[model samples]
Target: MTASLVLAGFGFGSVAAQEDATTPRATLRIVHGISGGPEVDVLLNGEVLAEAVPFGTVSEFMPVAPGDYVIQVVPTGQPAEAAIVQADLTVEGARSYIVVALGTPDAPEGRVYEVNLDEMTTGMARGRFINAAPDAGGLDLVVAGGEPLFGDVGYGDASDYIDLPPGTSSLDLRGDDDQVVSPIADVTIEESLAYEMVAVGQVADGSLTMLTLSTAVDPSCSAALGLGGAIEDACVRLTHVAPDSADVDVHVNDVVVAEGLTFATVTEFVMLPSGEAQIFSVTAAGSPIEEALITTDLGLDPGQAYEVLVTGDTEDLQLAITGIDLRPVPAGQARLGVIHASPDAGPVNIRLSDGTAVVEGLDFRGVSEYKAIDEGTYELQLSPAGDDQSVLLTSELQVTASIVYDIVVVGRPESQTLAIVVLTAPVPVQAEAIASPVASPGATPVDASGG
Candidate 1:
């Protein structure tokens, strides 16, 4: 039988697909921790397991039968003969493993470590450290103002799992001489879970950083089971982009969460329990839920991030939900996506100034996948899908390294309030600073409509 697979957000949760309890199977995942590396694909016995996985991104857990198999890693799109790393992996039944592709871009290596999923003491967290940093030799994983959690970890070595108290604390990677190699700030160690602290990148080039991976079923989902629910929280953000709509109050499940939210504003991520239908209502500021202008029932999945856009004019407003991928970009690159949210704008096309199409025939409420691109400034043209001659907007898009950007096409066509609003995902604090001309504000959205 084929392995059961489940898509995950930031790699959380257990085997979602149902299987026989007596079947002997193992779950496996791949972590792309190679610093400054090109996107790579993981193949198991000639079948593509994970495709085009960029640096610092984790693959979804896949269950496979217990056996010895040929595991290979190659630059994405390359043939099997071009494999950079290849080995035989023996997976045992009823266990989980994380195969990390580490080292530099030119010279890569792979290491497999079994995750600690065994039951542990209450009120404690289990963690381990892996030294993937090629140049940083003999490192120590320590909690700030505390003793070392894992010490003298050599390159490519994995430490045994250790239990720690649940709390928030800063983490540090120190060198053999007791010098700090990298400091990870405000890491939360939740009770009854396990984590992998991987030290990646090169010390000489100042690309040293840490990647934290969780290997547990989300606790929120467990808590939901106790509350007669079956799923974890879904991360939702609200963006008020309907230019002509009056200031409004937003309600979820009959509770007013945002009041007097005006145009061009957005709410932080709201954690709402999933596995049930949720009522979302919008009304005039200070108005009762009975007077809601629009009410809809939304069912969301656990462990996913979604952006809900309030679009169109007040008379014919609508809600549009777009899923956001929070995976990290590879070193020296950026992830960009486009959302067609304008009410009056029909199907549109986005192209570079040189007439290269970036997105084509994207209709209202359509969302594009986040595409990776090199860091630079470029002129972009937006126009009606079929009629390319009549350009609707022209603007410069500035993007920096290691950032994710989502550009929303907003504003009504008649009132000429058409524009593009940019939303950015936070950069990884443990990342090395990429030397680029782009300033701190990595991406800026220009007024495409000349408003």
Candidate 2:
């Protein structure tokens, strides 16, 4: 009975009241899609339900005693006391459960995906997309070269399941503007199975990405439904690390990549033609540039990233180039990545609402996974990584749809230096929601997470 976070509607009801109408039987299939995480074990009321369940694993539906069982998802080989996610599930005898283990080790949670097969046409595959990317905006899941499947699937929003012909298809995730953000190729759907396409991970960092889980139809079907970081180019990131620097302009081969760079300013990952030598220039901010303050050469490599930073005093300005193996974002939606560029601030953690840690262990030159939140108002709270009470800054941002941004933390602490430099560009907007041919469950409370 360790402390656990309660999920939406993970509430209580008398087991006897639920069993009054039918026999005591419950069946469930577990879908695992946690990225940059370890294999997990599932336990029901302290009993092992499944073991060594790896990432992207879909378990066969297994029958369980229908009652008030506390469901827990623990890392494989770990004791039950270390469960990462747990829930109280009381299911009726005639019904089944599709328990999805989503989020990352950083934000793991158990979600139940429920489907009514009778509402779907016979002998067809039922599918939908659930936006569990935490920070991603509206998303669309479409079959490659085919019509759109789900559109404008917002945060915590689940599209009504649509029935598709069973076969192999290339699945791509696009932003609301319809540009392919995630190129998940070659997914095969079998006959009479229900599939849940989960969009996970950050667009900037390639972990916790998109994956589909197909569960069979029927109470006992196959146990019911079961469930790469390869960088091609060397992404380049720029930052201003000088603690007391003024707003400055940065250039690469005469191209103004960043402008008005105050202290601790950072740029989003810029795709560079890797394996070449490039020169970087720093000068005072504004168009009619004065003499460059500092110029340096960067010999970057393919399949890697280099951070070109400007640091030191006004009298002795300097350049520091550091090589890193980092991931980049794809096209489609606007990506908002972060960086720890404040040299005065040793290391810090960033959180959304001071609850979920978006970035941690972030020192100067550290980059955070691009968080893909919707185009709306969001308040980001900054605190020293582990301490809860010592809040550093509270920033409220206004983000628009389809625009990618690089939110840089700039300024020094002594002057209470804190401000944001947002670098923005528009991405493709997806088409509006295409009506699903399959009938939706009427008036029922839709659990967007499928549970």
Candidate 3:
């Protein structure tokens, strides 16, 4: 005889009254026929009664209304196959019944992994590290919307973990020395859930540094201030306020025109020729503040000077200004340089002053060495291997005679979709500066080591 059990209803209300007004009621005692592991599911009348049941256990479903009802026995973790029994059984007011749950064949086992985060000490921020991509190296971590609890520190290993004060936060994991990574945000690090950080490196180089040029404009001056104008004309005179001595690069539009100008005074004049309208940009070489562009129009005059106050974007960070000059390039030459924080490798071009291409097919690694060519004043453009991927530098570089200049490109990582972290420029070669009989027309190719 099968070992069956009955489930008698022990309640204050009648089972028949609890059922649909016209339907009868029944009580059920379900039992599993065979089981090694305690994993089973019981469903009654098309509704799942229990999720998982223990082996050889008897579960009671009291006061079940009787009707054309179906009973299903499903093995845990297996939903495709189940045993069903359909019968029309009526239950007397106090009658009890038994339900035999026949077990099916066992199913295959699945795998899962658990992730955990260690509790952080007080006053410390909660932090985690992940290695999503197994291949790349040098991940850049960015904390958006707030300052990092821990200042600029490198995470060397892919699978390594870091500690921070427990709280809700988002993080980005980038490669190429933090130049390219993924942003992971809105991660709720509950006291229970273990946080797993993944690190994925960028496929290409990452943009590591940004050069920002900040200059306050006089509200009264108006003349469409920028970096381009007539030959031998002065665009804006920028007074040097920091780093008594340093090297600077001047950019008209986005194309670099001159570099390596040493400055040792408080006032520096940046000269631009007339005829073309463009924005003027400047940046220091080998300094943390490497690139800066003029976003506002300078409304410059031929011989007027613009006083620019230099300050650090953050406290404790030094404001170093290098290189300053006021000059114009001769016609037929174009000034050029690499975009400091660009993400890809490709050809860089310059529109000449004489409706011709001054520099063509110039290749640059982001953050590498920059070169300048003597092309007449026109619009400068940078294209990355294809016509669809080109960014026009803001101004036309008015080329004049005899004046050498530097152009610095400033790109910020936060503003870009892709980040490049590796060094893209050629290695700089060391050489002594030899006095040439005549200064070169465009950017004089300095020793590569100077990059």
| Candidate closest to the true structure, highest TM-score | 1
RMSD of each: 15.1, 20.5, 29.4
Model 1: how far is 273 from its true place, Å? 2.7
1 or 3, which is superior by TM-score? 1
lDDT of 1 by residue, 1-451 (tens): 1111212112233343223222335567788878888898988999998899998777866656556678888889987777877876666654667788887766677777776666555446688888889889999988887899999999888888888777888989899899997888988876545688888888887778888776552233222112222224565678888878889888888876678998988775555655457778989889999999889988776644568888877788888887665433334456678999888889999877877667889988889876655577877788999999998988798877556678888887677777888876533211211111112221221111111
Off by over 4 Å in 1: 1-231, 427-451
Cα lDDT, model 3, residue 412:
31
Say what the RMSD of model 3 is.
29.4
Question: What tens digits encode model 3's per-residue C-alpha lDDT throughout 1-451?
Answer: 1112222212213224333221223334444433233466765655776667664454533445434344455566545244432333333432334444332234211111111212233223333442222234444556665543333333222233454443666755455554434455665443212233333222333322211111111111111123232222443333322223256654555545445544322223344432234454556653322346323233434333233323222222122222222211112222233322232333555433333343455443222232334324445454444452455443555544223333433333234422211111111100101101122122121111112
Candidate 3, superposed: residue stretches over 4 Å from native: 1-375, 385-394, 413-451
Better of 1 and 2 by TM-score: 1
Model 3 lDDT vs. the true structure? Answer: 0.34
Clashes of 3: 75
